[model samples]
Target: MIRGRFTIYLTLLALSVIFMLGFFKQMFVMDVHPYNKDPAPRGKEYSKDGDFDWGTAVKYNPKQKLLLKDTVENILHPIAPEFRIGDALPDTVVRQIHIATSWRSGSTFLGDLLNHNMGTFYSFEPLHFESLSMSTERRLDLMNNIFKCNFHNKEVIGWMKHASKGENNFLFQRNFRSFKICENLLPGKVSCYMDKFQSPICSMSPIRVIKTVRFRVKLAEEFLKNDKDFPHFKMVVLVRDPRGTMHSRSHHSWCSGEECINSTVVCENLEKDAQSAYQLAKKYPGKVYLLRYEDICMNPYEEVKSLFEFLKLPRSKGLDNFIQKHMFGKESKKHPYSTFRKSDNIYMEWRKTVDMGYIEKIQKDCSIPMKTLGYHSFSSPFDRDNFTISVLSKASESIWPKNLS
Candidate 1:
């Protein structure tokens, strides 16, 4: 009787232990490894008579492969795992983009567009604080370090480091405009000494974008060479039709302060800018985006959508609404620095604003670049405006396509 009773008790205890273990297993999920190494898909390259088009981006995606793999994994194990936000950041890659543009190429509009993206640490004309004073090699070296996020160049890096509460009395002007750094610092927020300079940079959104008209796209080849750099760098070269670009430059007093009356000046600058943009796009397939200002103004919705897709940022209503307010509809909210011109007419405003005599000179000097860029060689300014009209009729076609050979 005693042996039988003892056996029954042992069986009950074993069963109870098994039941408790099963209950605890169901209640909690333990993920020993929190990071995912699966990389997202990238836009592919295609030859479109030397223009970057939507077809490649539309069809090829590196993410699609990851998506399929994940689907299969899920199907194999029919249980869904609970996700913890804190540890999930390693799943995404942080992107660092540089907008390499020339003077008066609608870069301000582009800058504002990228600035609106969530978790973007955007700086305008970061090199404006220097460049003119430094040698070409020195300036390039300084830029190299800044893009690398290692403050090695004391002269320029000094400008990026010192911040103040009021109009910064620092030598670098606005680099550290709102913050007084702590004498000693820690890794996280506890180490931060000020709030005004405290930016909303977190793990999930780790993109640092600096828009500069200073650095040419050609100078950025070094950063793109590295596949394993800590802060991965990408570049987008923004170009504008020289007629408009030069006219805008003249209006803004940008072309060497002399009378920039010659179209050769426009031609020479456009040649350099176009070559840099074209070479970068060709060399770095997914790393370089050749964005045209006229294109942006033409179909802002699709243009910006491609840009955002390249940046790996999700679409925001704020950006969409901004485009609607600025680029779409009958009237746009005028920018302080920008002239009041309709988006459609603005790209061709050079026809009206520029001197007629300069047309022949521009055509002579700039015909190759103009044709290469798909800008029709105008026998006269009338053809240019008419060409602009035809192009605007189908805003889907971009003149400075990234694939332009």
Candidate 2:
């Protein structure tokens, strides 16, 4: 009888323990809060009697808290300021100047000349071989911001160093600009070719000159098509003799395929470029400056001085020194010879190097265009029947050094 009672009591105690444990497990482990549960805290409840109860309160997870903090930080950070008119013109008005041109023109030499002048920042070929997909506004915005921060101003470099963070920090060095040009970061933004121009950034400058070559006609078409804000902008149309241009274009590694051939197509293109330049000069008489490459190379100082005067920039003592250094003798070694060779003798080297057949073909194709630009017609005393062909042939032989035996 005693053993039976003891066993029954022990069984009752074990049952009680299991029941308590299962109840606690259900409350603490099995019950899950629904995703749509009331977000308000469940800490306390107060009735009219002022009775109070305490419970768990809702709080964000640690990971969630961290994410929120990061979001706030990003929102608070100041974005780089974009170029805008009426904005305090950064100490230097010419924050950046893009030397736009077809390859192998004297753009590099011109770039060097601009670089030597104080207060002018040079970005060589920033837009060349770049795509034009970016909306002109966005491109201008980016350019303005970049210039605001990166414009090699003697005063701003120190501030840039302090404000620069992460990748931008490295841009404070002068050499950084050189690296940016080589890497073609600006061009890379547009997939390596300039298809359009809509940027206010380019317009913001008191002066912006686009150095261009054979596509001068196409560029004129673009300007006509697009609505631009610059009423007083200027274009300096630089031309070299077609024969000389062809000679330089042929040997230049950058010129390839059709451009390499001194065929009728090439002559036609040159004629179109020259005519286009003339047409632009006619259209915007005061705004267009026609500069012959041969004339400029022969009398660089005079030409550059006149150019600066035309642009309304102060012709300083430093600019005079730059012209002297780059214009004459071995001091000009700093200039890239492959692109800017100033041999008065080699100006018309195409006559010697290009074949007679090609010369005749070019003359025939270019006669109309040449005449349009005021060149003597081949039909004149130059030649009776095939005047165009004969004149070009004679001129090619007489003028082009590369053609000389």
Candidate 3:
């Protein structure tokens, strides 16, 4: 009788323990809140009337608990597992991108388009605050480090702290939720943001982009070869017709330097960069993309689709809406710096506005680059004025250096 009672008690105790464990498990599952509960399904276009929530798009894992960190290494390092050796990066890994372009090259619009995607972390001209005193080596290091999401560096931190705040902020036009949150913690927001949010967001984002006109295209070869930290890295060399580029520069007061406005200097850089781009494209294949600003202005939807394809990122509705609203709509007031543009006509505006003599000069100086870039020199004033006569050639018709040889 004693043995039987003891057995019964043991069985009851076992049942109670199991019941308690089940209760706690149910509570844990119910209480666990994901950072983004309603992940707007990938590739599904959001409602035309609704605005896409960028915060939700960040897609921070709900399962991973956030650990507060005081050290740079702890904070900046990505939570994602390292990518193994492969031609294509796994969906889990971030793809680092650089937009190598010159001023007035429609880079702002392009950068914004890329940023509109769900998982992109865009850094706009992080080198805007780059000192003249910085050596080429140091600048390269800074560029590499930015790709690595190491914003804890003093120089990078200084840039964030000193950079312009509003429309002209070099970081990004569309602020991340992390950045917005960190803003509330200021006095030390710059460092605080870099440590707690910016670096981590950048490192974890599936596509990390940095658009800069400061760095030359040739320098990218080093990044492509030397940086093992970012295995899936690519660059887009965004070019525009010199006539359009120069005419656009004329409108802005700050574009006074020889590098900015001089037809000779501008054309020469383009010519050299074209050769470099051609070589890079050949060597790296899919890694180096040459994009013409006019092509996008002409057919934003198709061009952008092609760009997304090149990046191997899925097309999203936010991107579609952005292209539709920005590319087609007419704004009441013109903000020079704003991405808002009458894009369809803006590319051709230089033809009507620029002096014929200046056009002739640009045509002469920029002839080689123009040819390589699929642009044709005007034979006459009528030719320049005639919208029917296409000055742009198909991508295939443009003679690369090897083809020319």
lDDT of 1 by residue, 189-295 (tens): 12122221122122223455667766656777777776666345678778777667667776553457322445665567667777876676677676777777877
Q: Name the lDDT value of residue 181 in candidate 1.
A: 31
State each model's CA lDDT, in order.
0.52, 0.40, 0.65
TM-score of every candidate relative to the true structure: 0.62, 0.48, 0.73
* Candidate numbers, best TM-score first, in rank order: 3, 1, 2
Candidate 2's residue-wise lDDT over 1-405, tens digit each? 533332333333233223222222222111222122342232122234432211110021234334433533453222222321112233333322333334455655675665554333333332231224334544444333344433343223222333233334222222222233222323222201111111112222233333323233435433432224333344555545554455566665756656445456666666666666556555545454555555556567777776665554555567766655555545434233433253443344454455655455555766665554333333332242332242122232122112111
Question: What residue runs in model 3 are displaced by over 4 Å at the alpha carbon?
Answer: 1-92, 131-133, 164-178, 185-193, 395-405
Ranking 1 against 3 by lDDT, winner: 3
Error of 2 at 325 (Å): 2.7
lDDT of 1 at 380: 60
When superposed on Cα atoms, how far off is each prediction in RMSD? 18.7, 26.1, 15.7
Worst 10 residues of 1 by lDDT: 27-36
Cα lDDT, model 3, residue 71: 19
Worst 10 residues of 3 by lDDT: 63-72
